[model samples]
Target: MDFELPEEYAAITDTVRRIVEAEIKPVIGAYETSGEFPYPVIRKMGDAGLFGATFPESLGGTDAGFFAITAISEEFSRLTPEFGYAMNQQAMTCPFTIFNWGSDAQIERFVPDLIAGRAIGMFALTEPGGGSDAAGAMKTTARRHGDIYRLNGSKQWITFANACDTGLLFAKTDPAAGHAGITAFVVEPKRGRGYRAHPIAMSGLSNCLRSCAVFLEDFEVPVENRLGAEGEGFKIAMNALEYGRLTVAARLTGLAQACLEHSVTYSKERLIRGKPLGEYQMIQQLIADMAVNIPAARALTWRAAWTMETGRPSSRAAAQAKYFAGNAARHAAQAMADIYAGYALADEYPVKKIAAYVNMLTVGEGTPNVQRILLAEDALGIKDTDRHPVRNRARGHLSR
Candidate 1:
């Protein structure tokens, strides 16, 4: 229950703050408008080893803890949500997942390349057919054919798809095994045999190349690329998400903090009814509530990170942290809009951009509502600890 970040972690946060202020704040709007992936920015992060902060030094990292990683996320996100997310995906999410699940050969081949920012990696689980019900709605299949597995399916909303050279792809390997049939693979599009990745057009989170829908049609993959074991894809994917959810929670906290700060600052300077808006009772109330929420969100996120670092299973805590922080960010954005009135709607005003960033973060990674279900399941001690498994499908078949 300690709320204090360690001195070393605090130092890390300070370092991250300087990096974000210098590199991201100046051109955030332009990046958002262009909707281009920030490759140069990513290269800077890679050079700083920001992408591999928590990874083992043996694999080219500083070997910081998960909490330290979240601490950095919070600081960076406050400046620019896209910048924070892109860096995390590069530094922590994609690399950590691969390092944790990828084979030694896969690790040797991919981790260094990814960390160097020479290549990029993405994790895809969302699909067009099923957004929340990822497992049952996953229509992608990877069938075994001797030494090679031929994959045929499509994944939508795949983050970093445009720039990522490699992906941790989830597909059904044993249609007969249902969720158990799901398998994780270290899939590269160029080595793709028959895969096609097309850019998906989306607005709002324009800094991100809207999650691309990757199509695999008889894409041949070596058996060695199979992550973990057959029937283990679902588990590996869930574990990766458990870690990723915390990172998202941290980012949401940062975005919410930014919204609150913006609103507070504007309220202090803008006069209304012959006095500063901060002098108005209603405006003060909004600002006060916002102030209260940011720390609560940070505390929850850090708790979850601490739990994970301590080797405890923390799905409930993770879900609660993500759900609360995401909602907080969205509410803070709206509050900022209310405080600024017409100005909040203007693209030039930061709150307008803040609203878009918060909205996307709320739904991405995992939606807030799904997190609620996860929290309930964990609290009630549901039959399955794993909440993401396809509920309607039988164990043996992919079909519902």
Candidate 2:
């Protein structure tokens, strides 16, 4: 297989790098310090079409494909993981899921604004009770009344839930049906009533990008807002997460690279015993580990993206990539910490923040343990993670 990215993909990466350098880097620190969302920078990213890579041209996207999205994720994450996270919320999971499952009218109503960055969106599936078994453990319920569905439940760890204009919310319509009973709905927190979101303070990436606990108390969504059929929410949520995992892997890959770059630079310049730190054997070993792992993480991420792009089964690929990349990022961050020693914790250096960012990656999309379980299940032939109806549908939609 050809490992080289197309020239167009390289250009896209350059564009994202330039955008980060010019717009995000300058104000990111202040925004992070104050814990405020960077609306202006997000607007710039929207204007540059950063959120449109995986979408079709008809819907304000460049149809740049999954690889382009992967490239963009890495570049945005190289400087700060928040923008990379934002890109996933705005473009990959929320809008893409709606585009795939929503009616044409729904797509027309929601996709453009999200892709243009004029509006923000979120995917709410994880609940406070449990995230790994979100479907089976979901306590949220939806009751149908005429043309409306009254939703009553709480969703935890919903990224941008407080600021989102619109989002996809999942609730159990048939609690007895278990996973099959879950259903997806298009929620308009801003326009609709009875939706309340409270921000959950986080130590890492909390300043600009934040998550929230969302409460839906008698929140009403129109029947038209329902995605797919009843009991299809489980499939939709899982499918969306496959895409989310790919982006998460890409972000971790970028974070690992950042750690490596910083560690290498510090090792070469800092002198110990009148010799550069790079000359020391221990430092060299650490740098060598990073140098080897970053590319491996990146390659795995690209392979996952390629599988999705080619309309092939990708759940296994995504899990493997995310699992490996998360480990690589953690290793790189620890290595950077070891290399920088006390300086790693200083506010002046970005190393501390980068290391903290890696913490979020380990648990965000799916925890490393969850990935391990999936891999183990696949190995034992207990389940075929790669094959799914959603994968087929995504392939067709993306190929279009």
Candidate 3:
């Protein structure tokens, strides 16, 4: 398999890098301190035609496909991993879910705003009962009431809940049906309706995005708003994660690259024991290990993306990439910190922030334990009925 990215894909990401350096990074520190999501910075991202790089031109995107999304994600994340979260939410999750499974009207109503960046989008599958047991533990309910479904229960740790223009939500439509009864819906929060969102003051990632606690008090969703058929929310949510894990893997690839860059630059400049730190064997080992880990994780992530691009089954691939890359990025963060020594604690340097970024990535897509369990399931030859929707999506890409 050819791992080299096409030239155009490289150009798109390089453009993203330039915009991030010139417009976004200058104020990242300020956002970190204030716990604010900069609307203007995101608007700039929209104006630059980034919000929909993966979407088709008919939907106001570059039609760059999954690779473009991965490219954009990696470059932004190299600076700070938070923007990657926003990208995944906007371009990868909600949009991917809608474009693939939503009704024609649903796509027309929701996707254009998201693609334009005039409206931020969010995906909520995690409930108060969220985590490894997300599907079985989900308690949110959507009761059919003739023309509309009434949504009750709450979702926590949802990115951009308070700030999003549209929300792709999952709820149990039939408790007796278990996972089968769950259904997906698209709601317009920016237009104002049944749901309420409150900001969550998180320990990390406060600067790049905000997590929100969303409460649905009889939020009315029209039957037309239903995503996919009734009882398919579980499948939709699971499929969304396949793509999400790919982005997380790529983002971690960028974080590992950041770790590599920081260490290399610091080693050349810092003097220790009457010599440059780069000359030390121990420092050299750290750099070598980081360099190794980065390309290793990046290769896995790119392979996962390519697998998706090729329209092949990729659940196991996504899980493996996310699991390995997350650990690699975390270890790289530590190595970078060790190299920085006392300076690691200082905000003036990026290593401390790198530490915080990896903490979030390690758990964002799904924890390492979850990925391991999935890989074991695949190895044990368990029939993965849950993988069909995602697999079908990947396969359908070839037809497109």
Best by lDDT: 2
Worst 10 residues of 3 by lDDT: 391-400
Candidate 2, residues 306-393, lDDT tens digits: the string is 9888877789999999999999999999999999999988878878789878988789878999999999999999988875754433
TM-score of each: 0.90, 0.96, 0.93
- Model 3 bad stretches (over 4 Å): 1-4, 26-36, 384-400
List the lowest-lDDT window of 10 residues for candidate 2.
391-400
As for candidate 3, its clashing pairs are: none
What's the true lDDT of residue 95 in model 3? 81
Candidate 1: residue 390 Cα off by (Å): 21
Clashing residue pairs in candidate 1 (N, C-alpha, C atoms within 3 angstroms): 51-91, 176-396
Q: State how far residue 379 of model 2 sits from its true place (Å).
A: 1.1
Give lDDT: candidate 3, residue 86.
78
For residues 1-400, what per-residue lDDT tens digits would candidate 1 score against the true structure?
Answer: 4368889888987877776777766766577678677777677667776667666777777767678778878887887676776654576557777777666788788888777677777888888997788888888898898988898888887878767787788999887777898999887777656776677765555654456878778988889888878878888777777778888899999999898888888998998778999898988888888888888999999998876676556566777888999988988988899999989877778877677778877887678778877777767887344444321110111211
* Runs off by more than 4 Å, candidate 2: 1-4, 390-400
Q: Is candidate 1 or candidate 3 better by TM-score?
A: 3
User: What lDDT is obtained when candidate 3 is compared to the true structure?
Assistant: 0.80
Q: Per-residue alpha-carbon lDDT of model 3 for 1-400, expressed as tens digits?
A: 4356789888988888888889877987787678667777777787777767656677777777777777788888897577767786677788877877776787777887776777888988887776677778888899999998898999988889888878799999998898898999998776647789888766545654888899998888888889888988887788888888888898888999999998999999999888999999988998998888888888888888877877777777888889999989998999999999999988688887677878888887788888888888878878562356343332364221
Worst 10 residues of 1 by lDDT: 391-400
TM-score for candidate 2: 0.96
